[model samples]
Every structure is written in structure tokens, then in C-alpha cells.
Target: MIEEIRIENLGVIAGARVELGAGLTAITGETGAGKTMLLTGLGLLLGGRADAAVVRAGATSASAEGVFLVEPGSPAAERALEAGAELDDGALTALRTVAAAGRSRAFLGGRTVPQSVLAELAEHLVTVHGQADQVRLRSAARQRSALDAFAGPTHGRLLEDYRAAWTERQRLTVELAELVDSAQERVREAELLRLGLVEVERVDPQPGEDLELAQEAERLGHAEDLRQAAQVAHDALMGTDDAQAPPGAAALTDLARRTLEVVARHDEALGALAGRLADVGYVLDDLAADLARYADEVQADPGRLAAVQDRRAALGTLTRAHGGTVDDVLAWASTAGLRLVELEQGDDRTAELRARLEDLTGDLQALADQISSGRAEAAERLGAAVTQELAGLAMASATFSVRLTPTPELGPWGAEDVEMLLAAHAGAPVLPLGQGASGGELSRVMLAIEVALATAPSSARPPTFVFDEVDAGVGGRAAVEVGRRLAELARGGAQVLVVTHLAQVAAFADRHVVVAKTEGDVVTTTDVRVVAGPERVAELARMLSGQEDSATALQHAAELLERSAVGR
Candidate 1:
């Protein structure tokens, strides 16, 4: 339930706040007094499209904020919490702002969020029905929904079952079509996988083999130069054929160690130096032996060089076709083999899909029949209840009907189409709601339907309902009946807010709010305030007559209020 709404800089409403409660609350005012601004504020708070034109003149922005008291585990509360909104004390604050530059923002429970978040919450929070909704009721799909809503829990369960079966049938049918349609594509893909696998298996590349082979090829291709360089380095490190050359480092280190050993008797530091020189001599000898072995091992093998190069080329070809390296190509081949098996199983899959499709179609047909039967039963009850409501609305001779006609093709909803038909008077041909009824008559018909649906024994209805001028063109006792039925809906545990001009309708409000406009030399502003006691009567008087001071109008307003109270 919406506990309150605060609006700023929106239309002629500079700033106003209205505290709302459960039951029927009515907002009324003189023409041009900006009563509609209340509903407009609600629309903004519910994430309606924002327009700069809604901003007051000279104002930079317009904003509307609402506080809703939600059930503990309701969908609305869950969604707000999911958006990181803090639902403090079970109250969620929804806000929307529209800048004069056409920018818009939305907030949920003080957290800034996308406008769609507010919209999703609004689905379960409120249901707004205005004069335009009467036109929407003309649609066949809308008619179907209305009938189902009025049909109560039994119809709801049937629809749930039907939709589930229908969805499965659709899924199977689409899969079957796709599998049949793309047969050639699947075949081509399988053949490509086969060829790739054959090439990879034939080459049989090993991981890291490419790098090792490349290194081997480089060494073999320069075998002569490598052997000569190795021999020269070995001879230089050990000794040369020239005897005049300074003794090799090994011989020099040995002579230094021998000199240090002779001086060790004179100085301790010289003894330590003698030991280090002896270790160096040992290392030089080991290096000389390793160099000689390396020089002997270096040899040229053209046959092995050719074989390594050819193997590298084959591996390179595989790498180029599949991946950047031999390992990557092997990985692709492994995955491709799995995919090839799946593709080759298409024939088996087709049989399986055909079997599943047959089972789903049978299930869908049965569910559709059940849905049609439920709707047929509901149509009768709905038509009777609405007709009874129409009688109270002063349309005694008019007949309302719900027509269920079967279609050749079953749909997600059902196999039948629904039409809400009306006959305005005796001897009048029954026509669809869109074509048969006048605006005023349509208003009454829609009101009747709403009242009937509101009285249904279902807990799935929206918490708040805003009806903007739903009583349009209605007057006399019919207007009073409309108000009474609205109050009835409220008594059914839903909060109803009605925007009305009729005194008869306003009289039935559990709480009355009046939009009062003040005109200044430069600007006009509207204020919304709750009216009670004598103030409400005076406002109703003003609605009944042009002047609130008129005694006759005042008396009529008083009696109307009294009558409405007694009726309640």
C-alpha cells in the first residue's frame, strides 16, 4: 500500500504532499485546479516516461516520491531488496526525478537505481486504470485477461497448467525444425572435423618436439663451423703448440701456489693465498678436460639434419592449419573429436526429438481442452456478475456478455479467443466493447467489470488501484453506485484512490482530498490538502453548484454524504 506521496515542481503543483491510507480516497477540485496532478505524480513515481513539459515553468526539474508499505516476503519487497534498497521498517520509498533537460532518474528505498527497477516493483504495488484503460479493454487479449482475472483461482491454475504445456510444445517444435532445417550444415561440419582429425593423426606431432627439432637443425646446419670453434676454444683454454707463449693460466696458477707455499713459513696471509691458488689450479684442470671432450663430440651429420628439418616443416604445417603451436593443435583435435561424435548423432537425435514432440503435443492438446472448459465455465459466471453490476449502475436493460470462440491453431494462452460484447439497450445488436458502447456506457461497463473482479476471492490482486475519472460522463444514482462499488473494492482489502469531479462519487470517500489553486499576478500554484467535516461538504457543494455558499447545494451535499455513510 502507498502510505504517502510527495510531489515537487510538477505541472501546476509546486510542492504538495498527500498522506494516503487503506480504503477509498478521493481527490476532487474545481476545473483547472490541477487535481489530475495527483495521478500524474503517481505515474512518475511508478516509472512512467518523463517529459520536460511536466516540469513547472521556470523550474529546473520535477520530482515525485512515494512511500509504500509492503508485505514481508512479497515480490515488491524482494525486488527492492535485490536492487540493494534498504526496506527499513517494511516501508520502501520510490522516487523519480525529471530534469528540464529531459534527463530522468529513479530511486528505490533511497538507493539510486534504473527506472526499470521502479517499474518492476510497480507491477505488484499498484494498478492504474484511467479513461484510457477503457480503450485498452477493447482488445481481445485484454478481454481474455479480464475474463481470467474474474474467473478466480480455478481459472488461474488452469492457465498456469496450459502455459507450461504450451511452452514445452513450442520448445520441441522449434528444436525439431532446426535439426531438420540445418541437416546439410551439420553434415558439412562433421566432414570438416573428420578431415582435420585425419591430418592431425597422420602427422602425429609431439608436445615441445618442434622446439627441440629446430635447435637440432640449427646445430647440424652449422656443424663444420661449430666443430672448428669448439676445437679452437679447447686448445686456447688448455695449451697452444707455441712454447714461447706465456704459460697457460693452469701452469701460471700452479707456479703461484708453489711460490705461496714457500712464503707460508714467513707470513700467514701468504699461506691462505697459497691454498686459494691451489683450488683455482684444480678448477682449471677440470675445465681443460671438459673442453677436450666437447671438441671430440662435435661432428657433422647431414642425414639427421635433413630429417629434423622435414619433421619441423610437417609440424609447422599442422600448426598453421589449427593453432600457433603443435600442443595447441593437439588440444583442438581432442575437442573436435568430441564435437564430431555429437554431430554424427543427429540421426538418433531426430528420432528422439520426434518422440518428445509427439508426447508434448498430446499433453498440450489435453491442457488446452481443460483451459477452454474452465474459461467457458468462467465466462458464464463473469457475464452474470457483470450484468448484475450494470443493473446497479443504472443500465438495467443493457446486456453484457463474454464470448469464447475457438480458433483453429492453439496459442500460448489457449485455443479460444475471448470477446467482451455489449448491447446498449433493448433491440440493439450486440457488438464488441470497442464498437458497441458509447464513452459513458463504456465507462459504466468497465466499472462494472472492475467491481466484479475486485470482489473475486483471490489474493493475487494488486494492493493499490488508481482510477482517474473512471466515472466520466456518469451522473445521478449511477455515479453514487460507482462510488459505493469503489468503496466495496476498498473494503475487500485493497487501497483505492479515485480522481473524480462528481459530488456523488466524492461523497463515498473514506478520506477526501481537495486540490485548491491560488492565482497570483505572475503565477498560479495548486495545493493538495485533506478535507473533512464541514470542509468536505463545502467542497462537495462547490462541485454540485458553482458556489459553495448556496444553501440548496449544501443541503444536497450533506444528504449525499449521509446516504453514502449509511450505505457503507
Candidate 2:
């Protein structure tokens, strides 16, 4: 139930704050009493699209806000989360503002939101029916939606699963189609990758091999000069009679031995000299062995050199173009291998696709059956309830039926088509609702449906239903019956707001709000007030007899209230 609604500078409503409660709330007045303006304000609050013309003549902007108490895990909360919105506990406060400059804004739970959020919130908030809703009933989509709504939780889950699988299948089919349609293009691409990968495989370079090879080539190129210098040093170190000869490995060893021989003669000094000569001999011997190895290994094989050069050149080509590393080439090869396989094996891909199609179709059929069965059960119960509602609205002779027709072809929804059929009087012959919904009969039919489904709200406080012109052409007994029906619908839950000129309808209200127009210097204003107790009687009497002082009208108004109390 809507707890409160406030409007400012919107159409004929300059400023108004209407506090609402659980059960039926009737707003009534004379012709041009701004009853429709109140509904317009409500529409704006519910996040309806706006026109700047709604702003008052002297105002730059129009604003509307509503507060509702919702259940903790209601559909409204789920919708909020789905839309990436946050709610304040279980309560919701929605505000919408429209500027004369053609700009509009919406706020939910104090955070700014897109108009789309408002549209979603409105689903759980209110179900407003003017003449527009009657026309919507003729649509197949609306009928389908109604059927789905009537379906219980089992059908709901099945429809959800079916939709999920259907979407997955659609996505897979699109990808498969793209891959198949571009087969020739894929062939060209595969050819290009194969050439690149083959070149890389031919080389088969290892990690860091290119850098190591570069270093080796530089060292080999300097081998000749290194060998010449090493030979000269060897000759100097081993010269037998040369003065100032550099001591070779053998000479150093002999000097160490001579020092050690005098170890017994010259105690400390000779011992130290011997140890130092021993260290020098060790270093000299190690150096001589390394030099010999270097000289021996400096091979001058031109053929081997040519082969190394050719290999290096081939590797360098790939390195410079792709990356200066063999690892990069390996990565490219791995990627291309998968593509090549896909391009070469078309039959295997088709087989996999056929298998996938079978699985998806099977899943869809199971889900559809679940949905259909649940809907069958829901339709039975819902049809019975709606039939009872119609009786309360004085349609006792009318026949209402939920017609479920099975379809072989599965659409986005499922394989069942549901329709609501009706007959105005006994033996009138049942017909589609669209054909029979004339002379205000459709409005009452929709009313019955809405009342039955009203409990399925997104919040604990179901939105107040606003019927702008439900009693458009109805009056007297029928009008009274409409009011009684609205009151009856409001019994279990929800706040019903009916804008009408019928006094009998107004008599059924727990609260009767009267809208009066007041003219000022520069602008005209609309004010609404709650008429209670005896004052309510005056309003009802005025609606009844077009005069407030009629004794009969007052007595009838009192009688209506007395009857209303007993029903409650």
C-alpha cells in the first residue's frame, strides 16, 4: 500500500500531500474537479514518462514522490538488485521531477537512478488502468504475460530455465554460423599462420640460444689473435738461457722447493718464503693449463663456420620480425596450431554442433512441459477466483474462462497459448474477451483480473490501484456496485484509489477526498481535503442528489455507510 504521496507544481495540482492507508480510498468531486489531475500526479510518481507541460504555468518544474513499505524479499527488492540498485531495508521511496526545459530525473531510495529503474519499480508498485489497459487486453503478448503471471512458482521457474537455455542456444548458433559462413576467409588465415609456424619449427631455437650464439660468434672471430698472444707468453716463461726470463710453471715450483729446503736453516723467514713460493706455483700451473686448452681448441674449420653462420642468419630473420627470442616464436606457433586444426577439421565441428543442438532442444522441451503443467493448474484456480470477483461487480450472469491452447512451435515464451474468454449474459455464447469487451464491460473484466492478482506485489505494501475513469459512463446501482467491489478487493491488502463522480462509489470509501478548484490572481489552484464522518455524508449526498440539503440523499448516504460498516 502506498503510505504517502506528495505532489508540487504539477498540472492543476499546485501542492498536495495525500496520506493513504490500507483499503479502498475514494477521491471524488464535481466535473472538472481535478480528479484526473490527482491520477496524473500519481502516474508521475510511479516513474511514468513525463511532458514539460505538466508543470504549473508559473512554475519551472514539477515534482512527485511516493513512499511504500515493502517486504524484505519481495519482487521489488529482487528487481532493485538486478538493476544494480540498493534499497533501504524493506522500504522504498521514489521521487520523480520534470522540468519545463524538457529535462527529467528520478530518485530511488535517495540515489539517482535512470528512468528505466522507475519503469521497473512501477511494475511492483502500481497497476494503473485507464482506457489504455482495455486496449492492451487485445494484444497477444499481454495475454501471454497474464498467463505467465497466473502460473505458479513451478511454471515460473520452468519458464526461467527454458529462457536461459534458449538464449544460450541462440548465442552458440550465432557463433557457429559466423565460423561456418567465413570458411574461405578462415582458409586464407590458416594458410598464413601455417607458413609462419613451419618456419619457426624448421629453426627449433631454444630459450636464450640467439644471445648465446652471438657471444660465441664474437669469441670465435677473435680466436686467431688470442692464440698468437698465448704462444709468445709460453715461449717467454720456458726460455732456458734468457736473461731476465719470466719464471714459468716449473721455475716457480723449483724456487718454492729451494725455500722449503732452507726451512731448517733460516727458521721463520725461510718458512714464510716457502709458503709464498708454493702459492705462486699453484697460480702459474693453473694459468698454463688454461692457455694450453685455449690453444688446442681454436679450430679453423671453415665448413663448420659456414654452417653456423647460415643457422644464425635464419634465426635472426625470425627474431627481428617477431621478437628477439625463440620463446616468442613458440608462443605464436602454439596459437596457430589450434587455428590450423579448426580449419582442417570441418566435419568434426559440424558433429559437435549437431550434438549441442540436440541437447538444447531436449532441455527446452522439458522446461516447456514444466511451464505448461504449472500454468494449467494456475489457470484453473485463477479462473475460478476471477469468476467470483465478477459476481461481486454485479456480473453474475457472465461466464469467464481461461482457455489454454497447446502449440507445437516454441516461441520465446513457450509452447502454450493462453486466452481469457467471456460471455456477457447466460447463453450469450462465449467469445474472445476483445470481441465482448465493449460498453464498459472490458473495464470490469480487467478489474476482476487485477483484483485477483493484486496480492502478487513486489512489496508488503501493494501499490494503490488508481482507476482514472473506470466508472466513466456507469452510474446509480452499477456505480455503487463498482465501489463495493473496489472496497472488497482492498480487504485482504492494497490501497484502492478510485476517481469518480459516483456518490455510491464514494459512499464505499473509508476516506472520501474531495478536490475543489480555487482561483487566484495569476493562477488557478486545486486543493484536496479528506471529508470524514458527517462531512463525508454531505459529499455523498451532493454526489447522490446534486444538492447537499436533501433529506432523502442524507438518509441514503447514512444507510450506505451503515451497510459498509456491516460488510467490513
Query: Of the candidates shown, which would achieve the greatest TM-score relative to the real structure?
Result: 1
Residue pairs whose backbone atoms clash in candidate 2: 1-461, 1-462, 71-460
Q: Write the per-residue lDDT of candidate 2 for residues 1-568, one digit (tens) a residue.
A: 5778788888777887787787888888777756777778778767677999988888899888887777667787777666665666666787889999989998877778888887877777787888788888877778777767766455667788989998988887886787778878877887898888888888888777777777777767777877877766655444446677676656858666685867646587777777777777677767767777777787666676667778789888887767757677667677779878978776577668768978998889888887877778777877887787778777888878888888878767888788888887788879888797565677778888777676543223246687877876566566667888888777866678888778777778877788877765111233678889888998888888898789998998889888777756
Best by lDDT: 1
Worst 10 residues of 1 by lDDT: 518-527
Look at candidate 2 and tell me the lDDT of residue 35: 73
* lDDT values, one for every candidate: 0.87, 0.76
Candidate 2's TM-score reads: 0.73
Q: After superposition, how far is residue 224 of candidate 1 from its true place, in Å?
A: 3.4
Cα error of candidate 1 at position 146, Å: 1.4
- Per-model TM-score versus the true fold: 0.87, 0.73
Q: How accurate is candidate 1 locally (lDDT)?
A: 0.87
Error of 1 at 278 (Å): 2.7
